[model samples]
Every structure is written in structure tokens, then in C-alpha cells.
Target chain A: MSLLRVENISKSFKTLQVLRDVSLEVNPGERHVIIGPNGAGKTTLFHCITNILPIDSGAVYLDGKEISKLPAHHLAHLGMSRTFQKNNLFGDLTVEENIHLALAAKKPYRYDIFSPLISRTDIRKETNDILEQWEISNRRHVKVKHLSYGEQRLLEVLLAMASNPKILLLDEPTSGMSPAETAQTSEMIQKLPRSVALVVVEHDMDVVFAIADRITVLHHGEVILSGSPDEVRNNEVVKEIYFGGGAKKHA
Target chain B: MKKLLLGVVLLIALVFAMPLVLSDFGINLATEIYIMAIFAMSLGLIMGYAGMVSLGHAGFFGIGAYTVAVIGQHVANTYLLLLLSVVISGLIALVTGAVFIRTSKFYFLMITLAFGQLLYVLFWQLKPWTGGADGMSVSAILNFGFGEIVSPNGFYYVMGIAFIIFYILLRLFVESPAGKITKGIMENEARMSALGYNVRVYKLLAYTLSGALAGLAGALYAYFNVFVSPDLSGWMFSGQVMVMVIIGGVGTLLGPALGASVFIYLQNFMSTYTERWPMVMGALLVALVLAGKGGLIHWLQHGKSLFVARKRTGEAVSQQPVKKGEAVH
Candidate 1:
């Protein structure tokens, strides 16, 4: 069954129509990749799905419930989590502190101001485990401002995953990374729990093909093609838009 | 934690022993300082933690002061007046915060400033209840069922105990999970929201909590000075509290309290030497800004670390070579 379904979602900024009737679906545990060129409305679509941007038309459903009009935080509470294209971290806080906050998001007493956070043994252990799993234990005490760009990106993804969402939306997770860093990030994403579905927007074809269970090619605010990697690779329209002509290429 | 506890104990001891050495005026000044510290600490909760730069905090402060003055006319009980003042101020904050938290950055600042000015005007115009521009004298605080606490020493002890309790509560609040989320919102609001935190709710809570604390301070101020005026609600007072927060250190739990002490001390000292004390205060503030960011507490912490490093170096060079190796890493 589809865990997340975007039905004909459309969004526009002033005169520019960014997402024009774009729709897609993600089955449970599917790694769906949305690949497009610049100005293809991929990020806008993600924003619409996450309710960061109000849609001009159409609706979004999460787990068979309509969530098009819900706020972004509400969507997050309903098992949807997302990372920004740019680094979105608590730059003033320590790495472990950041993870501790993320872990507190879904906890029962997130707003309890009287209880000491350090006294919560379960939360402390979970935070430490996440830091260790992400291999950022050494940098736990360091402020996020001092972290490398690659580390910040990794932390951003780790923060999204900390909420333990049923579906995660990642926008340009590997952007501005070195090849080695990209390879490491791809490995990290590939290792995410199978119970969590992923919808990734990417410009990097290598990472796209590496982790995608199904590929959707977007062009000029519309979905040009949606299929398996091999099918997208063979499509004539996708070939013209991405590779720039009728040149034959191995699938 | 041990150091903090020791400091608290030392502070409590010093406060209890203050009347033995200090004059009546000095004790009165100390009471004012305690009140201002509570006010500044409330601002710190919203400005430092939640990143909501409110310019109308004095509005809540005035609301608290007025609540005390008006209630004191009929009910002479100090505890009941304080409770009513806090509740009334919190309710006002809850109403204002619902609208205020939606705006960001400069807009939030401007709106809060406007709210404060509005209260100032209301206090000035409501002459029947508030005594308008001339202000009203507060009634003596009744000690539960005991006699009135009209003496400076009695008020000093009362304010001191209240300050300690509020400080401990505020400290516990900042160290709690809610406080952690507030700091998270300060650093990155969108990320907190994306993590499923209703950013608005946390901000509202911070706003309301800060308002309640400010109200508590205002109530104490009315009792301490035996006066309530429209000036208490003015933007100048809000600015003063904001300055106190910055001068002490923005995010540190005790920074606001220290800042208030420094500000009040400097004000008193400068006024004794010169009539143009505001200019001297401004110059001193400029000097502080030029010295470094993070205010006086930050410098104090930095200097202490430097001192500790020097002391450790003096004692450890030959005694612990392996420990030095670990320190290098």
C-alpha cells in the first residue's frame, strides 16, 4: 500500500508556476527519487508535500488520510519528516544537544519545563546511540558551527531520522559534498531502516540511480516520466530533457 | 554543579548577613536590584531562549505592578496580591503572545514595543484606578496574618527569598527539556518545526512564562518602592531590562541577574559622581560592547578559565606528563 500519495499537487510563486499538476506515490519501504534539472519545481513539490508551501490545487495523502491542508509541524507529527536543501541545524548547540532536542520532539513531555532533561536516562541513552550510529560521537560536544560542511549535511539527515518518521523527504542531501562524502552519504541513506519510506529530490544522477527503487523524472513543473531506473533510462522524452538529444545510451 | 551549589550557598549567606553591615539605603538598593534581576531574567527566557525579541516586556511588568496596587487597596495580603498579579500578567501575555509569536524578528520587536507603549498610555489615562501620571502609593504588605512588613530589612529579606526561589525555578526551567527545545528554536525555528515541534506553542509558553516572572518582579517592586506609576510600563523600562539581559549575557541562566546587579550598581555609582549619568552609562555600555560579545558574564567566565589554565600549568608540568598528553588531544 502507498504510504505517501501526492495527487496532482500544484504550487506557484507569483507569476511563476513552479509545480503544475505534479503527482506521485510511494509504496511502503520504497526509495522514490525525484530527479530534475534546475527550475523543474522538484523542491517546490517537496515543499507542497510537506505543507511548507500551500498548494494551488490538488491534495496530498499520508497513510490514506488527506493531509493537504495540515501545517508542516502537524505533518511531522503524523509521521512525515523532511530535510532542507541547505543545512538546517541548531548551529549554536552542541552535536549531542542537537540530537537530544530531536529525540525530545516525539517524546511525551516535550514541553515539560520542570523536569531536568539530563535526568531522563532513556533519552540520554537514545541520543548517545544515535550519535554513535551516525559516527559523530567524537564531535558530540562540539558546537555545530565548528562542524565541516559534510558533517553538517550528515547531521541534518541524522536529525530528520531522529524523529523516527514513517516517511522521510530529503532534498539535495548530498549537495555541495566531495565525491567521497557523497559516497558516504549515499551509503548512509542506503542503510536507513526498511520500514521508513524515502522521497529524495536530487540533481546527482549517480546518487539517484544508486539508491532509488523507483525514479520519477520532472521537467518544467511536471512529471515527465515515472518508472524503474532502467525504464527511465530508456525513455525518449527523459533522454531529450536530461541528456540533450536522441543520442543512444546504454540502459 | 558543585560550584553552582557553593555559589548559591555563599550568596544566601551573604544576603542573610547584609543588614549587619550595610545601611538602610544599601538594603533598599539591594531590594531594587533583586526586583530588576527577576525582570531581566524573564526577558532572557523569551529573548535568549525562544529568540522572540519582545520590546514590550515592561507592559507585563506594569500590569503586575498595577495589579498589586489596585488589589492592595482592598486586599492587604501580600501573597494574594502577588498571586493575582502573576495570573493577570500571564493572561495578558497569553492573549498578546498568540498574536506576537506569529511575527518574526523586527516585526516582533516593533509590535511588542507598541504593546508596551499602549499599556503606558492606558496607565496614564486610567487616572481613577492607576492614579495616572502622578502615580499611586502602594499599601503596606501584610505578612499572611502577621503585622505589616514596612521596614526596609523586612522587605529586603522578603525580596531576597523570592529572588532565590525564582532564580532556582528559572534555572531548572532552562535546564529542562522544554528549555532545550526553546534554545533549539532560537538557533533554528524551521528545523524544530520540521522535527514535529509546534514552534508557536513553545514560543507562546516562553512568552507567557516570561510575562509571569516579570509580573512577579513588578509586584515586588510595587511593595518595595510603595509606588506604582505609568513609567513602569514604558518602553524605557523594557529597554533597560533588555540592556540588563545583554550586559549580563544573553543565554546563561544567571546572566540576567548579574547584569541587573551590574547595571544598578553602575547607575548608582555614576549618579553619585556626575549628574549626566546617562551619558556615562552609555559610554560604559559602548566600552562593554567594544570589549567583546556575550557581555560581562562571558568575560568573567573567560577570565576564570584563563586563570585556571595558568594555575594548572604552574602545578602540573612535571607531576603529570601522561595527563598533559591526554590534554593535548
Candidate 2:
């Protein structure tokens, strides 16, 4: 059974229709990529599925259960986590502190006021372990605003992953980075355990082809095609709409 | 940790010994200062940690004061009055915060201001209960079925103990998981909400806690002043506490207390020699702004670091100082 199923979702802002009858599905452990031109409603579709922006009409289901009207936070509680297109880090907090907050949100004692955060041995151990796993432990004590841009992006992904979601949605995780940084981030995403399914929206073709198990092309608020990378790379409509005319070979 | 402990111990010693050197009037003034510090610190919790700037905080303060004044006239039970005041203020905050937290920035400020003014008018027009514009005198706090604490020194002791207890509790809270979430919300509410936190619920809790603390201060204020008036809920009073929080230091744990003491003492000292003390106060505030954007606590920290650096180098420190909110990249 599919883990996530979006059935005919539509969204609009006044006369502008951002998403029009978009439908898709992802199985457990599949790395699905959504690619499109600027203003192709890729982000809007992601927002509709996550319920950040209420849909004009349609239904979203997780594990065959309807969850179209649930709030974004409720979706997160149901094992759906996402990263923002823009870096959405708590700038004033340290790296470890950021991971601790994400972990705390999942814990039963998130609202516990009397217990000092430093005294939570379990939370501290988990935070340290995650930081070490991400190889950012040396900068654990530094405020996030002090970290380099690549490191900040890494932290952003790590924060989303800290919740240990069954389904992860990453929106343009490498929007602004050098080619080296982009390759490193793609490698990290590819290394994620198969227990966590991924849905990514990316403009970087190299990263997309490197990490995607399947590709969905969107054009003018509609799905142009959905298939494996080789099929998507060979489709005539996708080639004309996305790659202009001729397909540029990628290494 | 040792230095902090010593500072706390010295502070306690000085508070305990205040009556030995000060006159009766001075002792009463000190008691007022302690109460105001609690008020300021409560506002700090919402504004500093939760990042919700409210302009109607004095409404909660006034509600607490009036609860004591009206109830104590017949009951004279200090403990019951305090409990009622805190609970009632918290309820009022919960109701208002539900509406106010949905709005951002300017809208929040206006709504809170409007709520405060509404309460002020209610207190002014409700002649039977509030004594109308003339205000009402309050009875002394009954000493826990023992006796009345009528002495100024005795009252000062009570106020000092309350201050210490509240300060410690607030400090611990700011270090707790809930407090960390409050800071996270302050930094980015959207991010917190997206991370599966019910942001509004956390904000409402912070608002309610702040109101309860303010109510605690207000209940004490009524007993200390022996009067309750509609002015307690006015916008000016709300502005005064906001200023106290800012002038002391917005996010620091003890900044609000220091701010309250400095503001009250400056007003007292300036009024002694000059009839135009308001102008003098305005000038001092402007000077503080020009000297540095960071308030007194930040200034003290910067100065101490600079002094240490100079002593160690035996030369003039020439590096550009790191500004607040700017990470050392």
C-alpha cells in the first residue's frame, strides 16, 4: 500500500490557480522528486499535501486514512516532517539546542515546566548522538547564525530528520549552495536509512537525478509526467517543457 | 556558580538589613520597589521570552489589586485574596490572549491597549464596587491568622521574601523545557508550529503565567499602598512596566528587577530637586538610548569584559566590539 496518496488536490489564490487537480502517490521507502519550472506549483502542491495552505478541493490520505483537513503540526505528529525552502532555523540558539527542541516536540515531557532542560539525560544523549552522526558536533555549542551557510542548510535537514518521521518532505534543500556543497548534501540525503521515505522538490537536475527513485514533472499547475529517471529523461513532453529542446547529458 | 551564589547571598543580607539603616518612609519605598520588580519581571516573561509585546499588562495588575481590595473589605484573608487574584488574573489573560495571539505586531499592541482601557473604564464607572473615581482604601494583610503586619519593616520583609521566591522560580522556568520552547517561539513562531508544536497553546500558557505573576505583585501593591484605583489599569501604567522591562534589559533574567529599581529610584531622586522631573527623566532615557541600544545589564557585561581585556593586555583595546544579535562569524 502507498504511504502517501494525494487525490485530485486543487488550490488557488484569488484568480490565480496555483495547483490544479494534482494527484500523486509514494510507497514506503521511495525517494520521489518533483521538478518543474518557476511558478509551476511544485511548492504549492507540497503545501497542500502538508496542509500549510488549505486546499480549495481534494483529499490527502496517509496509510489509507483520510488526513486532508489536518493542520500542519498535526500532520507532523502523524509522522510527516518537512523542511522549508528558506532556512528556518532558530538563529539565536546553538546547534545542539535546535536539535533538542525538535526532539522535545516528539517527547511526552515537551510541556513539562518544572524539569530543567539540562537535566533531561535522555534528550541530551539523543541530541549529542544526532549531532555526532551529522558530523557537526564540533560546532554543537556555536549559535546557528554563526555557522557557515552550508552548515546551516545541513542543520536545517538534520532538524527535520531529528523527529524521525516515517515520511520526510524536503523543499529545495540545496537552493543556494556551491556545486561542492550541493553534491555533499545530495550524498547525505541518499545515505538516509530506507525506513524513512523522502519527497523532494529540487531545481538542481544533477542532485535530482542522483537521489530520485522516481521523477514527477509539473508544468503550468499540472503533472506533465511521472516515471523513473531514464523514462523522465526520455519523455518528449518533459524534454520540451523542462530541458528546452535537446536533452543535455548529465554525468 | 560560586560568584552567583555570593551575589544572591549578599542581596539577601542587604534586604534583611534595610530597616536597620533606612527610615520608615524609606522602608515603605523599598517595599514598593520589590513589588514593582515582580510586576516588571512578569511582563518580561511575555515580552522577553515569548516575544509577545503586550500593552495591557496593567489590566491584569489592576484586576489582582481590585480582587484583593473588594474581597478583603469583608474577608481580610491575605492567602485567599492572593490565590483569588492570581487565578482571576490568569483567567482574564487566557481569554484575552486567545484573541490577541492570533494577531501580529501592531495589531497585538492595539488590542492589548484596548483591553486595558476597557478594564480601566470598567473600574472607573463601577462606583458601587470600585468606589468610582475616588478610589478605595485597602485593609492590611492579615498575618496568617496570627495578627496584622502593620509595621513598615514587617511589610518590607514580606515583600522581600516574595521577591526572592518569585525571582528563583522565574529563573528556573526560563531554563526549563517550556521556557526553551517559549524562546524558540520568540525566534520563529512559524518554524515551531511546523515542527509539530501547538504554538498558540504554548503562547497562551506563557501569557497566563505572566498574568498570574503580575496579579501576585498587584495584590501585594494594594496592601502596601492601602489604596486601589482605576489608574492601576490605565495605559500609562502599562507603558511604565514595558519601559521598565526594556530599560532593565529585555531578555536577561534579572534585567527587569534592575530596571524597576532604577526607574523608581531615579524618579524618587530626580523629583527631590526639580519640579520638571519628567523632562529630566526624558533626557536620561534619550541619553541611555544614544549611549547604547542594549540596556543596563548588557552595558555592564560589555564594560566588565572591556575592563578585563584592558587589564590583561596593559594597552588600549582596539578591536570592534561584537554587537547584540550578531553572531561571531
Candidate 3:
């Protein structure tokens, strides 16, 4: 069964239709990337799938269970987590504390007001482990606002992964990164464990082609095609629309 | 945490020593400050940690006071009355916060102010129960099994202990996961929500808890003052508690309490010499706001430079020693 399946979902904002019959599926361990131009409704689709925005029609299923009507916050417990296209970090918090909040949300006794978070050695241990694993332990105590833009972007991805979701959505994770940072991020995304399925909305073509096992092309609130990387690369329409005639330029 | 512990110890020391040094009138004033501190700290929790700035906090405080003033007329047990006050105030908060928490920023402030005025009108019109606008004396004696606490010193000690306990509870809560999440919501609600924390539930929880604590303070105030009035729930009183929070600092656990003590002490001190104490208070608040050092508590922590620092004449590292032809922008 697909880990996450959005079937025939449609959305509109005011008089403008934002999504039109967008259907996409991700199997376990699939690296599914969505590539599109600006205003292709890629982010709107992510919002719909994550339940951040209510879907006008059609249902979204996670592990074959309907989740279309679920609250956005509940989606994380159901193994669906996502990052925003824009930075949605806790700027005033230290990097470690930000990670702690993300990991702590998954715990059952988080509402226990009598127990201090500092006394919870288990959570602290996990926070330290994740920070060390990410090779950012030295910067753990630094306020997130002091972090570089690229670092904040990376931290957002780390926070999304903290819940150990079965399916993780990354919305333009490398949107504001420099070329070097983008390549580094692309490499990191490719290295993520296959136990998690990735659904990324990206404008960077190199990142899309590098980390994507399969790609879905979106244009004008519709899914142009969903296929393996080779099929997407050879498709006449995708090449014309995505690459703009023969020359390969970023969309 | 170390600072918090020191604050508690100092508070205890003051509780013991203040009554010895001050007159009965001074003791009475100090006792009122302690109660107001609890009230201010409750509002501080929602404002600083929960990112909810309410202008109707005095409503909960008034609820607590009126509960004791009216209900205590029948039930003389101090514990039962106090519990009733806390529970009723909390329940009201839970119901009201459901709708209030839906609004954010200015809408929240306006709605809370409206709710507070509604309570104020309720207390004013309920002439038989609340004694109307002139207020009613708390007829029940505060007897905690041993004896009636009628002496000013005894009431002072009781309020002092209550303040310390409430502070410790607030400290522990701020260090807890739930409290941390509340702070997170204050900083970034979207992130907390995306991380699977139910933002509204946490918000409502903090709001309810704050209301209950405010009620506790009001209940104690009714006992201390021997009267309950509609002004207790008035927007002016709510605004005063907010000023206390601002004077003390917003986020720190001890800040609001300290702010309350400072405000109450200054109000009493300034009134002795000048009938225009409100003008003095307005000026002080203006200075505090302009200084913007996070409040007096924070200002006191940072070297007390305003009083003790000596001006040092030195060369600025960036100021290139007036290089012969260099133009200074």
C-alpha cells in the first residue's frame, strides 16, 4: 500500500482554482519529487496533503486510511510530517531547544507540567544524539536567529525528520540556498534513510534530478506526469514545458 | 533556576523580617502587594509564555473575590471557599478561552476587555449577591482549623507563603514540556502546530490555569481587604496588573511578581507625599518604556549602570584616529 496517497484532491482560493484533480502516491521508501514552475500550485498541493489547508473535494489517505478530515496537527502522529516552503523556525529558541520541541511533541507525557524538561534525560539524550549525528552539536546552544539562512533551512528539515514520520514532505527545502549549499542539501537529501518516503516540492532542477527516484511534473494546478526519472527526462511535453525547448535551464 | 531559588529564599526572609520592622499599616500594604503579585504573575504566564495578552485578567481575579465575598456568606470553611473560587474561575476561563483563544493579537485584547467589563457589570448589578457597586464585606472568617487569621501579620505570612508556592509552581511549569511548548507557541505557533502539538489546546490550558491562579489571588485579596467590589473586575484594575507585568519584565518567572511589589510599594510611597501619584506613575512608566531594558528586574540584573557606572573616555576601535584627510560620515 502507498504510504501516502492524495486522490483527486481539488482546492480553490476565492475565485481562483489552486489545485485541480491532483493525484499523487508514494510507496514506502519512495523518493518522490515534484517539480514545477512558480505558481504551479506545488506548495498548495503540499498544504492540502498535510491538511494545513482544507481540501475542497477529494480525500487524502495515509497508509490507506482516510486523513482528509483530520486536523493538521494530528497528521504528525499519523506519520505524516512536512516543512514549509518559507522558514517556519522558532527564531528565539536555541537550536537544541527547537529540536527538543519537535522530538518532545511525539512523546506521550509532554503535557506533564510537574516534571521539568531538563530532568527528562531520555529526551535530552535523543536531542544530543540527533544534533551530534547532524554534525551541528557545536552550534546547538546558538539561538536559531543567529544561524545562517542555509543552516536554518537545514534545521527545518531536521525538525521535520525528528518525528520519524513514515512520509516526510519537504517544500522547497533549498529555496534560498547558494549553489554550494544547494548541492550540499541535495547530497544530504539523497542520503536520507529509505525507511522514510520523501515527497519534495522543488524548483532546483539539479536537486530534483539528483534525489528523485521518480518525478511528478506539475503545471497550472494539474499533474503533467508522474513517472520514473528516465521517463520524465525523455517525455516530449515535460521537456518543452520544464526545460523550455531544448536548452536545459532551471524552471 | 538558581536565581529563582534565591528569590524564594529572599521572599521568605522578607516575610519573617518585614512585620518586625514595619507598622500595622505597612504590614497591610505589604500583604496586598503579595496578593497582587500573584495576580500579576498569572497574567504574566499567558502574556510571556503563552503569547496571550489579555486585558480581562481582572475578571478572573474579580470572580475569585466575589466567590469568596458572596459564597463565603454561607460556607465558612476557608479551604472549601478557596477551592470553589479557583474551580469556578477556571471553569469560566475554560469556556471563555475557547472563544477568546480563537482570536489573536488585538482582537484578543479587545475581546478580553469586553469580557472583563461584562463581569464588572454582572458584579455591579447583582446587588443582593455582590452587595452592588459599593461592594460587600467578606462575612466569613478565614479559619484554617487552628484559629481565625484576623491579625495583619498573620495574613501577611499566609499571603507570603501563597506567593512563594505559586512562584515555584510557575517555575516548575515553565521548565516543563507543556510550558516549553507554550513558550514555543509564543515564538512560533506554526512550527509547534506542524510538529504535531495542538496549539489551541495548549493555549486554552495556559489561559485556564492563569485564570485559576488569578482567582486564587483575588480570593486572598478579599480576605485581606474584607471587601469585594466591581472595580476588582474593572478594566482599570486589569490594566494595572498589566502595568505591573511590564514593570517587572514579561518572560521571567520572578519579573511580574517583582514588578507587582515595586508598583505597589511605589504607589504607597509616592502617595504619602503627593496627591498626584498617578502623574508620577505615568512618568515612571514612560521612562521604563523608553529605557526598554526588558523591565526593572532585567535592568537591576545588568550591572545597575544607571546609578553606579562612571563614564569612561576611550578611543573607539572603529574610529580611525582622525586620519589626516579622512571624512567622517
Interface RMSD, all models, one decimal each?
2.9, 2.7, 7.3
What would the per-residue lDDT of candidate 2 be over residues B120-239, giving only the tens digit for each residue?
999999999999999999974747566788888778998998998888788778878889998998898778877899888889889999999998899999988889999999999999
Q: For every model in order, what is the number of clashing pairs?
A: 0, 0, 0
Global local distance difference test of model 2: 0.87
**Best-matching candidate per TM-score:** 1
Candidate 2 structure quality by residue, lDDT tens digits, A1-251: 99999989888999998888899999999999999889999988888888888899989999898888876778778888898898999998898889989999988888887767867999989987997898877787799898988899999888888888889999998999999999999999999999999999999999999999999988778887889999999987776776564354221
* lDDT by residue for model 1 (A153-184), tens: 98998889888889999999999999999999
Each model's fnat? Answer: 0.91, 0.80, 0.88
lDDT of each: 0.87, 0.87, 0.90
Please give, for residues B143-178, the per-residue lDDT of candidate 3 as tens digits. 889899999888989998898899899988998999
Model 1 scores a C-alpha lDDT of: 0.87
Instruction: State the weakest 10-residue window (summed lDDT) of model 2 chain B.
Output: B320-329
**What lDDT score is found at residue A197 in candidate 2?**
93
lDDT of 3 by residue, A141-164 (tens): 788899999999999999999999
Question: What is each candidate's DockQ, to 2 decimals?
Answer: 0.62, 0.57, 0.45
DockQ of 2: 0.57
Output per-candidate TM-scores for chain A, rounded to 2 decimals: 0.95, 0.96, 0.96
lDDT tens digits by residue: candidate 1, B1-329: 44557767877997799888988789988888888988999998888888888899999999989988888899877788989999999999999999989899999999999999999999999999989999999875748566778788888888888888888788788889998888888888888888888888888999999999899899889888889899999999999899899889887767888999989988897899989998977887788888889888898999997997888888777676434224311
Worst 10 residues of 3 chain A by lDDT: A242-251
Q: What is candidate 3's CAPRI-style docking category based on DockQ?
A: acceptable
